[model samples]
Target: MPSFYSKKDLFFQLFENQNCLELTQLPYFSDHSKETFTLVLEAAEQIAEKSLYPIFREMDRQEPQLVDGKIRIHPAMGTIIRKFGEDGWINAIFPYEEGGQQLPWVIHLAAGFIFQASNYSASVFPFLTTGAANLIRTFGSKELKEKFTPKMFAGKWQGTMALTEPDAGSSLSDLTTTATPASISGVYRIKGQKIYISAGDHDACENIIHLMLARIEGAPSGTKGISLFVVPKIRLDGAPNDVLTQGIYHKMGYKGAPIAHLMMGSQEECEGYLVGEAHQGLKYMFQMMNEARLGVGMNAVAIATAAFQASLAYAKERPQGRKISEKDLSKPQVPIIEHSDVKRMLLFQKSVTEGALALLIYCGILSDKIAQETSAAKKLKMEALLDLLTPIAKSYPSEMGVKSTSMAVQVLGGAGYTTDFPVEQYFRESRIHPIHEGTTGIHGLDLLGRKVWLQEGLGWKTLQQEIQHSLDQVKSIQELNDLGHSFEEIFLKFNHSAGELLFKRNLGPEKFLADATLFLEASGILCVGWMWIKQAISAQKAISSGALEQSFYLGKIETARYFMEYELVKILGLIPRFHAASYPTVTMEKDWF
Candidate 1:
């Protein structure tokens, strides 16, 4: 069973006391899990520390260029990524039956942080391939899976999820990609233009599997009419080697990760095979998309985490600000760390990144439960929890991840805005997340809109009960008692605030909907406060046990305390705003803008 206290010792000290992380265990962690996962995280850190981070600045400086309607990525990056595929990095979460590491999603996500933090743009295509590949495996026939799984898992063929169009984006029901049955055996004739597909035209792999969505003939209109297919850039039968560059998109960030505007079946037919039942594409695609939402959230957190580390290092080394107690203005202004405001920014960044990571990894643990639990009832509960957490997991961390990155830039001042440092790049990369899987508002609406209604509200109730349990546990631990009490107050404030909003005149329109973003933020903060108290309790135990890294443990306790003091303390404000949730922003005239 996962303790309220154990994970704290293993989190931040991942680099130094990874052995301690090794010693730590999750209730759902299989016997082989620690050995299997820690290396993934370590390897992720390696990629971030080595390959991706070094190139991030250059990546921002030189966005992917569209030359003759094709994208040629950084010279050695294609090879490096191919090496990543060869190394099983892309296939960690694939089923072992599929020639993958068969690791849990959380571990894959933990490792993902390394890649995304280092260079998100470069990893987008390969990672998206994993999602696309899994979609095929889940919904496609055995023939499709057998034919495509190996190469995709092995990174021989990359993958892309194409849902957006010139007019349809967010509204899948309104998409126009058309599909017609082919005269050929087991094939669907696909003809559509898919835009903004990452790795859509990359030369990293032999074939790019386009999971294109389209409307079947005489089908129900809107989302129900759409069917998904495994449409490859090049038709592959017995032998699979086609590196055709159809078209490329010039993008804002992630320049190294090529984006494409594909015109499928315009030439020789873009042969595709149906994955799931006709008109059930949206359901199947959501599996990958939901997974990607979690991935995107973690990516945002990782980027922010990297910025925090860099900013922390810079604040300590940059000799600009003087000590608050220093009488001498001439005292060479010690490092920026001396300034209370700078420290506050650093703390906020650290609080979000570390706290976000804690929640993200634990969500992974919950995933393991949802996947592995044998009992139907228990598995059902796990599924509900998973559903409840996904929106917050995707929405909360992503917003704060961007917030943290921006603050990192603030820490660097002018240098942060320029290409000289990578924080600005972190911000730029993070800026894409709100739109990556779903916008913050969508996630917000999901949380308030759908999550509250799912499983008869069992998931939300379970989460509230769990937080209550943690709140009680906080009172039991002497070291964490004060923080616990403070958190309890914050928790109650948040709960009361949410209740007022719900009871208020019906959560008015976009203005109230806009509050949905802040609602996600509050929920996420409350959730992490629970995680932090648990972590601090563990840190207290680690210190009691005469651990060598008491300083590290102490830092964990301190950071959690700081979070309670500042971040969690802010939850008190939501009460007043939430009371006005029923108001409508639609009252405004269109011409007012």
Candidate 2:
């Protein structure tokens, strides 16, 4: 049977050949999202392949620059970024009421995999803009929306979320940017220096909208005192002002997008408008930050997929070694793929990239349900679940994405380790993800310190129920029966581990955070294991009946088994690493390092 990457027939069959994914059949997939996602993915692939991929190397070489007090990217990048937003590619999931396509979030993200993978650096522009726009459309007042929404939506303007001050990186409460009442109507004066703002300034659009966090007069100290403001680059009526370029950064990777140090309200008062309520800025801004976090996860998935595909293709064609079975030394070497170790590496990349893709895509669909379900109770429940899952979605992909991309370069041998190949660049580009929105440590804390215990443990219960359901389905599949049984046992062990951690809270909560990172890893694996089972089950019925081609079904079943056997089996290893008797990390102290 033939192998097909665009397995439309198989996808249709999995959703029972319906036009949209049937959430009723597969609760993980949201309804009425399949076709739209598929089509958008198709479109994204075209743009990525044609426009984005070719420019990746060039963008990395050029990087973004400050020329004569102006932020400049590769000359070609301006056109590409503009075209991206012009395609409505940037406005995929915003409300249709606000002139957006109103496509489900699932499709938006699934399509995004192609764009990011093809050209990760170039993709950050529209990605950050959408992040900024999400804040406005979600919490901005009607007048603010009216003034900003059309320009942002139509690609006439770009957007960014400016939260990090020089003093505050991950510790947002340390921010010192100031916000004072404006003489201008319905606006505030923003005076602050923002650092590491991606897409912070660019010539791609006429104006740039910065969603900045600052403190108001008489506001409480710390993060509670912060407020979000919209500060535009261009003066009103299309007048060009002496905006502070400050400086543009040269990063290790993701060179196409400018990471800028912007100084607003440095001159004649920079105009701004309040988003949401005063002192409620941090709370409201989370809506955008959470979405961006999920987006970072999805972006990692796409880039990882691209790296895997490239390396796999390179391995198959780049002959370098003899097959294991070959006895003749005089004969020419076979492809590197014939080597068991190389195959193992490629398969590792494949399994991780695929599993990450499935999990991220599933989260996107859940986002759709959070909005469109019309059930107030169901919406609240799903929102909480989403909140719990977002950190996992973002950090897991980052943690794994770096590994997968690294393997891709290893597959290329020496050539991949250099700038001559894109894999190395992919490796560098993916590094920013885990650190940007939030550090992995921060995300782990959010999962363990907050999400796990929130709402009287409701989110954990919901996830547990879903895991049980997946495990139950796995028991029925003959091929997965043994692995599924093993997963069930390991999962139970995790539940016990959680209980022990809580019941034995003698150590400081900070010490307890030792294995918390591992805890996140374990839960992520289980989540993917559950998703793998779903994919396998869907593949099974079709492969058995000969409705689907044999190779595709077999691959799904094999990969699913791979996750169950290797990934699910990992829970055993993690428990030991997590609950160590002595932490080499803590006990040794800083002097050891």
- C-alpha lDDT of all candidate models, in order: 0.75, 0.76
Runs off by more than 4 Å, candidate 2: 1-20, 23-37, 239-243, 504-506, 581-593
Candidate number of the best lDDT: 2
Residue 55 CA error for candidate 2 (Å)? 1.3
Write the residue-wise lDDT of candidate 2 on 69-143 in tens digits: 778777776687678778887776765566667666666665666677778887777777788888887888988
Give the runs in model 1 whose Cα sits over 4 Å from its true position: 1-33, 237-247, 329-332, 504-514, 581-584
**Tens digits of per-residue lDDT for model 1, 317-391:** 898856767788876878888898998999898778877777777777677657767799988887888899888
Residue 477 CA displacement from its true place in model 2, Å:
1.7
Candidate 2: C-alpha lDDT: 0.76
TM-score of 2: 0.92
RMSD in angstroms between candidate 1 and the native structure over all alpha carbons: 4.3
